[model samples]
Target: AAVPWPEVYGAGGDSPGGAGRPTRGAGALVVVQDGRLLAHLTRGGRSVLLFSRPTMGDEDGPGATDPADVQAVVTVLSSLISVGRLSPVTVEKVNGTEVMSLGAGTRAWTEAGARFTPKGLVVR
Candidate 1:
């Protein structure tokens, strides 16, 4: 699935100006398989892959997860981090689960209706 650039960068549309401004590159691309969500954000022919670690027991329960929902959450977060709207503090593995700590400088997450807790990201 392809997520539009406007959706990733908000109404500002990733430029100094407003919506009428032309964006530089294509939007984000997302793929979901085996209970994992992988989002690719491309710019200037370069692509960054953001993979969400599969939740516990997701493999055991087939179709328990919704790709669209996961795509929405991961794409937004990944895009924000990729474009420097959000800063990542650290990435560490906790009990085999990847944990990313982000800086508190930006309220973009909150504006996007998502928040990070001690456990993980919560999207409303």
Candidate 2:
């Protein structure tokens, strides 16, 4: 099923200077599986895949915890980033915590426990 981008990140307005203008931000591609975040892919920036089990109420079921599922999500996101399908996302500090603005009224905090690996970043 193709999840609509606007459903994940609220509808965004046009960039200043019309449709051809590019917005500024650390562009990224967020991947989710079974209602749980699987990975966050940033071009030329930090990228991370989930390695720990999601907390209660964070996922629809248990499938997202599987290694195969994680790998699949990472592979898809990596391909998208490499193909230049990444979207602009804003990063800012709020109350000493780094927050990533996904779109209008949508924001996520920076994961603090992520570690770099040969493949990319893994967040526990």
Candidate 3:
């Protein structure tokens, strides 16, 4: 897919103002017949990664997210959960907390990337 120019592109005389308003790209939404699937690559693209790992010689497969990052993620999520700081909490009428956010954009780039989604989604 062709990338839409960043919002800064308008200030540089590329966009016609609103069209140039910075966007984070298609909002990472994937359209499907039944519902809007969370941002993820097609199943066909990710299937190869299930049973295969690549080397310098392999060009057909996607690379995996580094395992070394697991500790970092666990530590952050644990601390956030324990402290109830997953979302912001600065408001007089409505208090919010720090909520961790993740997306499947990484999976789109590599089959080996872990795809994340929100839990407890009740599909009616």
Candidate 3 differs from the real structure by a C-alpha RMSD in angstroms, to one decimal, of: 17.1
Between candidates 1 and 2, the one scoring higher on TM-score is 2
Full-model lDDT, candidate 1: 0.35
Q: Pick the candidate with the highest TM-score.
A: 2
lDDT of 3 by residue, 1-124 (tens): 3965222211333212211222234322122223322122122111111111222332222222232332233233345536874432111100010111112213322232222323211111
C-alpha local distance difference test of each model: 0.35, 0.34, 0.23
Residue 48 error, candidate 3, Å: 21
Query: Which ranges of candidate 2 are over 4 A from the true structure?
Result: 1-25, 43-45, 49-51, 54-65, 81-124
- After superposition on all C-alphas, the RMSD of every candidate to the true structure, in Å, is 14.2, 11.8, 17.1
CA error at residue 28 for candidate 3, angstroms: 14
Give the best candidate by lDDT: 1
Poorest 10 consecutive residues by lDDT, candidate 2: 7-16
What are the TM-scores, per candidate, against the unseen true structure?
Answer: 0.23, 0.31, 0.23
Error of 1 at 7 (Å): 19
